[model samples]
Target: MQRIFAADIGGTNARFALFTGHEGSLGLDTVVWEKSADLRTAEDLLQIMQRQLQTPLAEGDMLVIALAGPTHGLRGKLTNGPLQVDLGGVGQRYGLSCCLLINDFTAQAFAALTPRGAGAKVVRGRALPDTESTQTKAVFGAGTGLGAASLVCCGGEAGFRHWLAVPSEAGHAPFAFVGAEEHAYQGFLARDLGCDMPTAENVLCGEGLSLLHYYLSGQFYYPAMVGEQVLSHDTPTLHWYARFLGRFCRQWILNTLSRGGLWIAGGIVAKNPQCVEHPAFLQELAAGGDVGGIVHATPILLTTDANSGLWGAARAGLEHLRGQTLAASAKG
Candidate 1:
């Protein structure tokens, strides 16, 4: 068996998991959680995790880290916070066999392949037919920031199939406004941000939730307070927020052509499921003009597990180890 160390580091929290794998099977052994603000580097967090392990990481062990940002090669920085990772340095310092870096949403995409992801609640549309199981699937959610990724099955059959997770920065794309009312809201966001244009992330995350509440009610409160109000009663702010989220999700599905399905992850909708279950959200999602039928029929799932990112990282690491083994066999 081989040792696999995986981590999912977001803006607010970082999670680590240890797995024991042989062949294609992975057994999760340990998990740890820490506040992102407390740790300055990945190594520091690793040391903390090591203290809890009966068998610490050794040579030939694999390490995979998923971060909340666009990853370039072996290095990445969190989009919503001040955490940076250099995988090469980490690998050299730990004498690991393999070290990989990926986007947090990309990790979520991989998690979709697991039983936990398969068991997600269907919030909208019907499940895809088994014949179309190979079609593309998407995952996105709002938390400290907005995140998205798509999963595709490359050419292969059953046991030999390869899955790829394509990371997306769609949250950075320009948000669109339709009517005079929404146009005014857009202006409000721009002025609040002190920028020319507002991206989806600027108006769709935790801070955005608070900002939306402020824009509508003239009360500047935190997300927790707003979330409580939304859950406690039927508020206009809740309706508007749901509508905007639904609209954004609709655009993402269309953009990615996710005919297989779409899984909603992160804290926003997961904690406040009413957002996706509301009539306004459903109506907005199904309101596509010409392709309304397609949009309406797309499967929508919500994942509430907090450890999914860590599971995804471990899965990714096992795949990497398998690929390296295959390459070495070919060379031999």
Candidate 2:
């Protein structure tokens, strides 16, 4: 079996796991977690990984890291935080046979393609048509910020195989308001927060929840505390805020429909099950407007499992190993 290291880095925490692969099968085992706040640089985290590895680091072992940011060139810079590192340098310093860096959303997209446990909730949208050979899929997650990606699956006599996972910074796209109320809220966000370059992420993420609440209720509150109010379901402000979130989600789903379906993962949606489960939320999403025709073609929802990123990182490492082995065998 081939051994590889994989990690998913987020704002609050970092999860690391070891994957063992043979043939086309990959198994993720010995999962571990660490606080990102405790570490300074990416290399500092690597030292911790070295200590956790069951066996000593070898030249042939691979390392794959999924970060919550955009990878410019071969380097990735964290979105909500400041941490930039070179993928090639990390590989060389760690004695890795190879190192692959991917966006957290890309990792999540790949994980959605794989068969998941009972925890994953398939909320809306149709499954990929078996007859169609290559279908494109889109993925997005809301946490520190919104992340998006596109996944393409090719089908043949061999069955469906994921071909590509493309990373995107779609969260940075300008925000669009569908109704008068939303436009009013957008104006408020711009005035209060000085949000000139507002993106959908600005009004749809965790911070967005707080902004929505303040706009609707005329009360300013911290973003972290919005969850407590959302869970109680006692506040009319939060209820309306959840509806707004659903509408924003619908917009994102429509934008991603050029692909086959849309997958929503990450802490914001997964943790606030009550908000996502609200009747108003679903109704608002189904309420058709521009691009309403495409809503039927796309799927949207909060992924249930918290370990999706870890699973995805492991899968990426295993794929990298397979590609390297295939290339080596062809050369021989």
Candidate 3:
């Protein structure tokens, strides 16, 4: 039997859990959550994981971390978050085989495709198809960090689906500087807020929303309170956020050509479906120059799980481990 440990490390917090069993039988055990800022180093995570284990790790145990940052190869870093390190040895401390790193959105993309049914709801455009076969699909969302990934069918059992995930750092793209409002936002981040160039993440994320509201109306709200405040008080900042995100998502969705659908997932987007579905968002999405009408035709689904990084990490890890097992078997 094989055991797997999975972690979803975001800008704000990290979720950790262990799994025991194969694909269909995989279930979470000893789930733990902690603030990422509190743990300054990888060693801190290792210690917590060690204590959370119900039993000592055995030879076939594996670890997978779905990180909030853009992944470089197999390693990823949290933007203004945690220390990035090669986690290959993360399991060595427990006598496990190996560990894997994937972008948090990559993990979500996997889960977004395979629905738990309740998690996938069509929030805009047309109803989601039963399953997307040929056309590519995109999943992008904002929270502690902005995340993005593309999913397309690859191969699987007849009628079943296998997917390939293409992860991206699209949020890091410079906030589209369309007009004076956009330019002013950029200046505020660089001068008033201390952002260098101010990517889409600075304007669309939790911290960005708080700052936007403050800049627009002198009201102060933190990330935790931003969601509630935005709903309670509909302000120009919220409008800007909706339109900006509308354009941001519009471009990415068009870039991916995800006619299968465009899924918005993650803590921030999931918690506040109101923000994503605002008329401003849809209006801006359809306001694109040449491709505006094209975007309006795309299905938009607001997913509560945001790729289900915590669940995907363990399941994806199992997939990686099993692939390794098969390769080794073939060689032997």
Candidate 4:
């Protein structure tokens, strides 16, 4: 059996997995988790893997990593954290024959490409449109930070296909305010952060929720409490913030309509089930004053999964292995 290593590196934690190939199907091994602070860079990550697996690294060992940052141009800088990874340098140091660096959202998009058994719940969205060729899919995830990506699929022989991951900084795009409340929050962000430009990360992410709660309630609360408060449905502030997020999600979906449908992933959304269950979440999305009609036509949040990024990284590693084999066969 062929084996490959894959990792999903986030700001707080790094999830590593091993995939074993069997009869053209991939079986996932148990996931290994490590704190990001304990492992600073890709070199440090390799050291941890080496220690855990108790094996010597070898050439032709593929490593596919999905990082929480912009992964364009062969190098990526973390958006919310202080880590820089170079694709070429990491691969060289790890003694691996192949390495693929992908945006965390791109990894999530790969997971969204194939539906898991009874895990994915289809919410509000048009069925993926049929295309003569492969279609594109978009991914949106909110957690320690906000991340987004697009995947373009290309058809191949025998019902097989390949996918290209398009890394995007869409999360960092300027946030659009619809009404007085959001405008007020935008102003608060500007005044507090000393920057007028606020992205979706500023008002819709995990930290964003805490910030919103503080701004509204005039009380300091931990980020975890914000979720608890929202889940209890006791705080109107939390509900209002959820509506804010819904509106922003609507705008994002409309902005990336070419990608067909949007898939919301990450632990933050999954943890706060009440927010997802709130009727106002969908109402706010459909209640567009001007752009609401078009935005409402686009798909909203369907379902979220915790291990989507990890699964995506594994899938990418498998794809990378297949590509390498094909390239070697062509050369021979």
Best by TM-score: 1
**Cα TM-score per model:** 0.91, 0.85, 0.80, 0.82
Model 1 TM-score (2 dp): 0.91
Candidate 2 lDDT over residue span 1-332, tens digit each? 87878778877777887877665456776777877766557776677876765544553377878888777645786665656657657666666768888888878877764544213565665443222335566677776678887766543234334357777777778876767876777788888778675687887777777778777777767766777655457577656756766776777666656435566786676777676677877888788775647765555545777678877776777666666666698899
Q: Which digits, one per residue and each the tens of the lDDT, describe model 4 over residues 23-117? A: 34556765678777655556677778766655545533677778887776556766656777766666666677777788887788777544331
TM-score of 2: 0.85
The candidate, 1 or 3, that scores higher on lDDT is 1
Clash pairs detected, candidate 1: none
Instruction: Estimate, for each residue in 171-256, the C-alpha lDDT of model 3 and write its tens digit.
Output: 88888767887787688887866667888888888888888888888888897687887744466877777788888878987789
lDDT of 3: 0.72
The weakest ten consecutive residues by lDDT in model 3 span: 110-119
RMSD of each: 2.4, 3.3, 3.6, 3.7
**lDDT accuracy of residue 195 in candidate 2:** 69
Candidate 4 Cα outliers beyond 4 Å, as residue runs? 22-25, 54-61, 72-95, 114-118, 125-133, 258-260, 289-304, 323-332
Tens-digit lDDT string for candidate 1 (73-186): 888888767777776676667667678999888889877766557778889766533332778888998887888999888754465356788888898899877789989999
User: Who is ahead in TM-score, 1 or 3?
Assistant: 1
Number of clashes recorded per candidate: 0, 1, 1, 1
